[model samples]
Target: MFRDSLEAGARAVAAHFDHVLSDAADLPVLHAMRYATTGGKGLRGWLVLEGARLHDVAPERALWPACAIEAIHAYSLVHDDLPCMDDDDLRRGLPTVHRKWDEATAVLAGDALQALGFEMVADPRCHPDPLVRADLTLSLARAAGARGMVLGQALDMAAERADAPLDLQQITALQAGKTGALIAWSAEAGARLAHADLAPLTAYAERLGLAFQIADDILDVEGDAETVGKAVGKDAGRGKATFVSLLGLEGAKARATSLVTEACDALSPYGHRADALREAARFVISRRN
Candidate 1:
């Protein structure tokens, strides 16, 4: 139900952007942003709404900000799949933006989507509080910046060509910055938008993020492209540092279980405020795609 609600919200936002952005023929960039933002399974958006549910915030209000999170996620993937990055051709079973469109268009689309995410939160209809909107923008920016997701990406790439070697700690650190940062931001953004304190939620999201990454690493080793919707075994093939590569398959699975336990404990204070969160944590480790 939460995911369905978020999808409805995103459709509305996409329609809104399309209506406003259609006048510029020279700027196919805007259309690319709209297309990318509306795609995918909406895991990040669901996380935002789940966090907001903990605060008892209304779904309509949560939906718009959640849409913002989805936009940021979509933008990140577009850039991350470029030739300079992962060079991935497929994403969520569709050709990546760069492969479907031109490389320059893909780059511009990612840039525009980033701006659109912040703009959506700033819109008065989505958030009534200026301070809350500002906080969301700043928090999302930090999540996307060098200190967070980008730093993680840089670390991930550098580890591939590093002179020495990467231990489990280094691999985990990279995952924390890359995957964990955005997951943390999703929860933080939702909590702050609802005027709720995020101390416990932040802690829960941290563990949840780690668990999510561990599961991803495991899937890379065990999953096929039909199930994963992307290349598998490439991490090991390229000598890319990963939890599975360092910890072995069973060890990585064990670590994922431990993180899930830690995440569940962190949400104990919320009681039922975290029901959706708990479900999401379970889903994170168990999902095939």
Candidate 2:
């Protein structure tokens, strides 16, 4: 059931991407946008849909922010893979946007996708209330802007050139901004849509977000490039600090496990109704990619 919901959510968002991009002008940037958005787990989008489901928001209404988060996420990946950034040549087993197209095209594609994300949430179709739309747009800006994901990315790049690697506390704070910000927003979006309390989902996402990064750190150490779908062991190669670096491999796994448990506990308010989210928490730490 969990797998089914996740795959369905992915398809729904992918279809939304096509529907929205279809109205855009026929340009290379649009093509790059579509390419960058495809072929992923769609975990962030799924979180939006599921949180909406838990709050009784219709899937149709929920899809706006679901797809929006995915667009923003795709944009981050495209920009992160650029020559000036991580300089990766591959993503999801295919050429990175910059590698497949040119750097200029990749930049335009990522920028357009980010704009499209805000546009979708602000659209009347997302919510009839102007306040709801405004809220979603504002939160997304904070999550994706200088205060959030961008801050994290900047810290990561700085760490690479720093005289000393980031300590565990610094790494934790950085991941909260970088990888965890969007996920937190995605998880709590349903509550925002319903105008309900954000505390529950926010707590769940904090632990879940940290666990997700830990899992990625684990995969970097244990996974192969072919299996992980991008370069693996690059963190270690760069002598970067990660959960795995600060904690032993077993200790990192243990910490991730503990986080998943706390994440599941945060959903207790919803009882068995949140089983899929619980499963998602477990899946985060267990996935190979």
Which numbered prediction scores highest in lDDT against the true structure?
A: 2
How close is each model in CA RMSD to the real structure? Answer: 2.4, 0.7
Q: Write the per-residue lDDT of candidate 1 for residues 97-212, one digit (tens) a residue.
A: 88888799999999877877887788877788889888888888888889999999899888878886688888788888999888998877668977887888899889999999
Model 2: weakest 10-residue lDDT segment is: 16-25
Every candidate's lDDT: 0.80, 0.95
Give lDDT tens digits, candidate 2, residues 1-289: 7778889999999998898878889988989999998999999999999999999999999999999999999999999999988999989999999998899999999999999999999999999999999999999999999999999998888888899999999999999999999999999999999999999999999999999999999999999999899999999998899999999899999999999999999999999989999999999998988
Residue 107 of model 1, lDDT score: 96
Clashes of each: 0, 0
In candidate 1, how many clashes are counted?
0
Q: Stretches of candidate 2 above 4 Å error?
A: none
Clashes by residue pair, model 1: none
Taking all chains together, the TM-score of candidate 2 against the true structure is 0.99
